[model samples]
Target: MATITSAGAGSGIDLESVISASVAAKKTQLQQPITTKKTNTQITLTGVGQLKSAISTFNTTLAKLSTAGAFNKRAINITQDSDDPILKISSNTDASNGQYNVTVNKLATTSKVEGTFASSTSSLITEDGTLTITAGDGNEFTVDVKKGDTLQQIRKRINNASDNFGLTANIVNTSDGKAKLVIDSGVTGAGNDLKISGSTTELKMFEADTSSATPVTGSSMSRTQQSTNAEIDVDGNILTSDTNTFKDKVQGLDITVLRVSDKDSDGNLKSNKVDITTDKSAIKTLVQEFVSAYNTLIDKSTELGKRNTIVGGESQDDGGALAGDSMPRSIRTLMANTVMEPNSEMTGINSIFQLGIKMDNDGKLSVDTDKFDDALDDNYEQVVALFSGENGVAGKLQTSLKEYTKTGGLISQRQDQLNSDLRDLSSREATAADQLEKYEANLRAQYGSLDTLLAQMQSSASYLSLLSTS
Candidate 1:
């Protein structure tokens, strides 16, 4: 209320108190309903937000269950008795459930050629010529050796060439006061072999010919190592690869040959068995996670629609902040329908119950572990179809939940409408506050004028009374 600077000072009447009380009464009448409506709107908005969050989380779990990798996973085991593993292996979900007898005969080797020199800094190449180098799949390029170039300088020139493919050149000390130009293929494999030919006889010593009848050893040159492919025998079927790592050898399998298995005294190859099987425990965990997420969403949604009895005999729905809203009821119906309905498109296991997932009396899911494990053991494909296909439980639930939780969807639209209402209410409240302020000012002005008139009248009455007494 606007205060009067000199209100009722001469009238002996407390008009300020009266005007303040009047303004207060009017303020309550104008503001109380708006306050109540805004409070209710905020509460409902919060409840709807929580429901949307729960549905979004539930949809994530549904996505996890719907993926092919989750249901079609396979586990692998290899014999651990061997000190050095013959090979390391991994498989995808598409891997077959079987055992493989793997015999690693030899690991792939990279081509390494060394060119010996009389001394590290001696100018060995007496002529200037181009050395054409071929590496890995006939990629031919050339490096020029300048006249009077030392072995170390020639090695540096080769190492710095950009077109050298995967060839590396180094000058290694052979411990006889002479350095050797060691050239190695960057990648391991016979296909990645490095070959060199020169235009001059002096540079011919740098040629890499590991398959010579006799070891190509000159006074200062030798072939230290030869390029070779990896060899493995799978149940009498020999498989060879240029690289150490082999992929798609078996469907969905990748094998990296770590080392060659030890041979017996009779030269018989040692073998190991790799067992691939369905991962039942992983499937169980995914199912449990889905159940837990579904239960939480259901419990929260149910609480939002429930009514509670007051402390005394009266009954009220004060417990549900979102009481009488259709969204909660719609959510419950959608989830229940999705779970109970049969997947007509699925041929074998068309319903969740076939996978040993059952809804209890409290509307929560419980899994029968024995039944689930048995289903996984016997009918794994059927179990997978029940939860993952087009008409699968997870697929249907994901589609349905997306309708409610996606942008511009039902829940999103409802929240957007509520936010709009809050914005409008804020504007209305501001306008009401301004109006009430102006109204209180008018009331104070009117009361202050009335008090001045009353005081003047009292002064006249007192003067008349004095005149009559005199």
Candidate 2:
């Protein structure tokens, strides 16, 4: 609607100001409640969002602790009487608790062959032919060397061969201007010995083939090392491996032999005793995390119900936004009550308190570490069943969270309802503004007509008085 620029200007009665004030007063009355409710709804939405996020996080933590494997974690320690452990060991969750005596008889070795050249820049291969190479476990490959190929060139071809076995070729230039081509097995094992055969006439000078374990002498090249497997005696049971690392030999145990155990003065073999036990520390950490997350949710949820004293002004209470709200209040109550009460199916130590998880007067959870440790030591399997079973603490908490955090659940429905309320308020606000504008325009028009008629009547009365006096 267009506002008249000179409203009441012809009569000079200042009717524009009066019309504006009247419209403002009516607008306040119509819009105040809508604005207040929208503000309160926004605050409530924010609070609900915080509460939902906290609960979801806490529920996730509970899920991790509620698993059977989480409680079954094991720790391994390898010890020797007076010397350092010769083997590095690790275990998985499926590993059982046991002590094993391991004696290392031998450690695996890689094979090496060294070929002395007159010079690294000197020609190594005089004829173009393929050089057959064999590595770990009798794996063989071939590299075609061109005629008049230098020491570096032949080494590159051997290193870059596509069908290359686990063999690496390196050229070491000596101080006397001579170079040596050293080929080493990339793996360590008994049958993984490096062998080279079938080269050109000129390349025969560097041939040192040990395919049949027979040493080739009277050549520029010589076999410097022999391939061997790692052998260890575990509790009188002999074990051999191509690599020093042994897997599943002791049932979920991985034994990586670093060195052979040193012998005592009496020439008796010193063995390492590996003791594997349940890792109670892991279970304790999980429980602590769950408690922390649960307390965070409880604190945030409780804040939604707290109210402060107010004296005739905007409520000083931070929770005034969510005051009288049922969803948040009920959620807080459910979480508190569920954790405190016992459920069916989880026998004996059904409640977390039985597991030494205690609650304070202020509704925060804390673990009595000594008591908790004792409970774990005495009733380990019972503790696992209490948290991971069908009617466990985590199971119950997850059920309650699913009701609110699930798709189209309580939180989602509340968000949708708040959005609808905002939309309705916007529509009402627009309608109210239009109505006020129209009301002001009608008032200005009626008052302007009155002012014009009053001025005409006064002018006529003045003229009559002037004529009668004359």
Candidate 3:
């Protein structure tokens, strides 16, 4: 057997030291302290996520409560002013003489006027005296027709010569059984303008020589077709309309009635031109919503900052050690400072502190209710000016919060980094555990082999000594 020196026997590397070193390296690389913090971070993250969700819900609710529907709970009412407002007339003449103009004006309040005219009523002319009536054989009749033609013979003659006259004749039975030949104009205004022409005898028909005769000049008169009552309540008083001006009906407010029939390119109704003025009640409701939201935010912040006792020991931490931290303090400070800070963009909302909202040492807010009410009463417009338009406190706060919590925000970036660290640590720990198992197995095998070799050498030396003594 070859002489096996300690150098040749096995590796000089300490297996325990190698395992311990691998473990330490993994621990350092993995940042193992994070394991202890995982529970704390999870609790804090859950509480923060819940708080963020609550705030989002509160914002949505506040927006809904601040709408027009919330402020104005009354229904809009409409009514027609008068009964006999519309008129209908039919006349018979040439195209130039058939047209007529109609003008509508606001009678009592304002002298605003609108006008339109009929295109034409020339079709009202029903008949002409010069009728070249041809018989069925296509021969013209040489009949001596007087000015006063009985209604019966005219009907018969027109019916017999239907092809030439192009007229429909019918003897309508009256209620008293008296028969009359009625001539209905095929065109709308044709029958309304009956004239006699081409015969001297037909001229007498224009004048009512007999009491029973119908005269030309006194044949038609204009008549009114009245509209029904349309009424609705405006504020507390009843408003009526025949042809109501939209402006007069709504009182001080101007509402445009968009006709859905005429749609724009985007399939939306074209807005009618109108100006609207805000009411006092509307302004009041807006102020109330702002106040309510402000109060709620203050209360929630205070609740989040309060310390509580678990069992007999009082905790110095707000809410709880796991749940509470700097987040609530930061949010409260941000809110207070934002309201107090002066900016060119938000001139009126420069200082909510001036509006009687104040903070305490514990980072909680409170409103001086009486002072706020007095401010609203004394200068309501100033309150509206502070929070109504584009440069309002609520608008600024919304913008700031959106920027802070969005995907690429500071908090979001920090959370991402922490997640990455956690994953890397877990992976390294798993790798270290695998390496430790392999190193331990190799050390056991080497030590077992060395012990077996020492036992064999001792047995051989004892047998040789016994042989030498013999």
- lDDT winner, 2 or 3: 2
Candidate 3 is scored at a TM of: 0.41
Candidate 3 lowest-lDDT run of ten: 108-117
Report residue 79 deviation for candidate 3 (angstroms).
16
Identify the leading candidate in terms of TM-score.
Answer: 1
Predicted candidate 1 versus true structure: per-residue lDDT over 18-79, tens digit per residue: 87888789879888788788988999999999898889989888888887756787788887
By lDDT, the candidates rank as: 1, 2, 3
Query: What is the C-alpha local distance difference test score of each model?
Result: 0.81, 0.78, 0.43
Clashing pairs in 1: none
Q: By TM-score, is 1 or 3 better? A: 1
Candidate 2: residue 283 Cα off by (Å): 3.1
Worst 10 residues of 1 by lDDT: 211-220
lDDT of 3 by residue, 1-470 (tens): 33222321333334445445655675555545555555555555555565565456545544544332333222222221223322222111111111112222211121111111121111222343544322122323322333445555544555565343333446555566455333322211111222222234442322211111243343221111111223333333444443233343443232222111234699752222222223345444555565566557656655654556565675644464324456666766776766566556544544656666666765455667677666656655455445534345565565565554667864566457657665766776567667666555555555546645666677788899999999
Q: Each candidate's TM vs. the true structure?
A: 0.80, 0.78, 0.41
lDDT string, candidate 2, 386-409, tens digits = 666446677778887889998899
Regions of model 1 farther than 4 Å from truth: 1-12, 113-184, 195-223, 306-309, 313-321, 346-349, 458-470
Model 2's alpha-carbon lDDT is 0.78
The most accurate candidate by lDDT is 1
